[model samples]
Target: MPAPFRIYNTLSRTIEDFAPVKDGHVGIYVCGMTVYDHIHVGHARAMVVFDAFVRYLRHREWDVTFVRNFTDVDDKIIKRANEVGKDPVALAGEFIGHFHDDVGALGLANPDHEPKVSETIDGIQAMIGNLVNSGHAYEQDGTVWYSVESFPEYGKLSGQKVEELRSPDEVPGKRAPADFALWKAVKPGEPAWDSPWGPGRPGWHIECSAMSLGDIGETLDIHGGGLDLVFPHHENEIAQSEAANGKKYVNYWMHNGLLTMTSGQKMGKSLGNVINVRDALSQFPAESLRLYYLQSHYRSPLPWGPEALPEALAMLGRLYEARENAEAMGGSEPVEQVISGLGEDAKKVFELGQGFTSRMYGALDSDFSTAQALGYLFELARAVNRLANHKKAKKRGGPVVAPALAAFASVAETLGLMAMSSADFMAEVKEKRLAAMGVSHDAVEQLLTDRRQARADKDWGRADEIRNQLDEMNIVVMDRADGSDWKVRLVAAN
Candidate 1:
């Protein structure tokens, strides 16, 4: 049987035990990118959070059907395409390609079902027809609008009163201020689809409702998106889906928090502070970005900073180093014997490693507190490093740290961190950091080569000068018995 976990539901505003519609199965649908532009770091948060979440659930043996949709025919895409003098669908397709590239580089697992509004027009229209037949929606002037008053639970998801809300728009066809369009009428120059309400694209909120139901069922096990979406978008979804289907829209509403700047402002294109995922990945490892997000509670607003990736890289390096140290040890004695012989450091590592799985489960099961779960891994890493300092640990500590190794493997399996081998991790770090610093890897190697020759010739002063020169570029030169290796060092803030 799969392990049970709890998740925070935006609808109830409480963390609740997750029970799937079908036993041991989860059906989730998350609103994906609009595909008008490349996904920025802020967008990547939702991508990474849900990706890791699905990874975690599957790791615990839950059969998950994850669906993330693309709004390929949105107003934003049409406007952007017109501005760029391109066909709307073509522009969206271009950015969808870019989205895949950015998300692929970020090392995210693709959602099981990546539905698109353009591809699901029939399903979308059927849903709108259902709403119209049910009297929850009305057709006027070739446009269809959902009447908010028809559904008394209009603000149940967002907890906003309809009377207190401002007019959604000053559009002429809308019956009430809160009435939102289910099918938008054709405009002068925009993409149009043939529907009962005439030629127009699906409204923003209706796409998710239709897609979620078509991909999963009338009710989704969990519907997820950014916290920023909880209001009009998700709230309207609940209204339209339930009102039309006569069933609950979703059993659990899972929302990840937004990424905010140090000034407490959310990153947005309008703010001109959106950092594209490709640009961030160009300078840092994909895992660094993943760590930066997982370092905090999923529901906490992550503060994006200049040093966020660097600091996360340093933390990741520490975990890798500790795991590598534990892997370097050699022994086959029983774990208890090794622990008893190696003293408290060994005993601490053994107990912590033994207890780590349940503690990690406890944290992750309770609203997916990734930060708390990572804390346990960090504690285990620290214990491993401390124990490696003991004289006997290197030779006989393998038996004792075996469980610690398994703990690290569990992290890789569960969280998708530390997934790379230590050698690959360090090499990629050097490659990316060196590229970011505008330093040549081969040039650094040549310098190391020169430093080694100088040392061979007993030219201590010359070798020291080369080492100092490398240090100036934030590169650390490690001289070992086998050979000398160079690693790019992060700035002091890291």
Candidate 2:
């Protein structure tokens, strides 16, 4: 049987126990990118959050079918295509490719179904036809608009009464301010499909409703997107789907909070404060970006700053370092025997490691509290580091730290962090950080060579000078009994 978990449902505004529509199965639909441009860090939050959530669900043995849609025929795509002298569909396809590249670099798994609006026109038109037949929608001047008044529960998701809401735009054919377009009448030079309402395209909100219904079902086990989507996009989705299908649209509404700038505005392309995922990944390892997002609770606004990735990378480095130290221990004794001999630090590590999974599950299962889960991992890492410092830990402490090793492996498997071997992680960090700093490996290696020769010649003055030079370049030298190695410092130099 799959383990049970609770999640915060945006509709109910409470954390509720998750019950699948079918036994041990979850049908989830997350609103995906608009595909007009490369996804920014703000967009990546929803991507990473849902990705991690799905990973955790699958890790716990839940059968999940995840569907995320692409708004390939949106107004933005047409406008961008026109600005760039490209066909709208071609522009969407280009950015969809870019979207895949960025998320792939971030190590996100592809959704089970990536339905595109262009591909799902049949379903969109069918749903609009249903809404019209049911009197939930009306057509005028070749445009179809969903009648918000038909669904008394229109504002149930967003809590805005239809009477109080102002129309988003002063379009001519709309009968009411709150009523939104289901089918947009074709405009010249824009992509259009033949529909009963004449040649037109699906509106922004209806694409999700229709694609989700076609991919998942009338009712979804979970529907997720960014918190900013709650008001209009998601609220309209709920209105149109329920009014059309006569079934609850989504059982659970899950929304990830936005990435906010220091000035207290959400990072957005419209706000002109967006940072593209491609640029962020160019300077940092993918896991650093993942860790930065996971460090906060999924529902909390994550503050974007200059040092976010660097600080997350440093945090990740500590976990990796601790895991490496724990892995280096060697022993064949029983864990209890080693713990008894190695003292309190060993006992603490053993206890924390043994209790890690339950604690982590407790945090994650309760509203997917990644922040708390990461806090537990950090606590376990600290304990392992303390145990590694014991004199007998290296040769006789493997048995004592075995559970800690397992804990580290579990975190890697569950959270997608620490999945890389210590060597691979260090290499990636060096490669990326060095490139970001515009420092060549040969240059750093040559300096290390000079410093090694200086030390060999017993010239402390030259050795210290070269070391200072490397330090100026944000490189740290580690002198072991076997020789010397160096790394690009994880944090910025003061």
In order, candidate lDDTs are 0.91, 0.92
Candidate 1 scores a C-alpha RMSD against the true structure in Å of 1.3
Candidate 2: Cα lDDT at 296: 96
Across 1-494, the per-residue lDDT of candidate 2 in tens digits comes to: 99999999989899999999999999999999899988999999899999999999998999999999888998988999999999999899999999999999998899999999999999999999999999999999999999988888888888888778765688788888888899999999899999998999999999999999998999999999999999999999999889888899999999999999988898999889999999999899999999999999999999999989999999999999999999999989888788789999989988998899999999999999989999999999999999888888999888877888898888877778998999999999999999999999999999999999999999999999999999999999999989998998988865
Error of 1 at 365 (Å): 0.4
Give Cα distance to truth, residue 252, candidate 2, Å: 0.6
TM-score of each: 0.97, 0.98
Model 2: which ten-residue window has the lowest total lDDT? 162-171
Model 1: how far is 171 from its true place, Å? Answer: 1.1
Best of the candidates, lDDT: 2
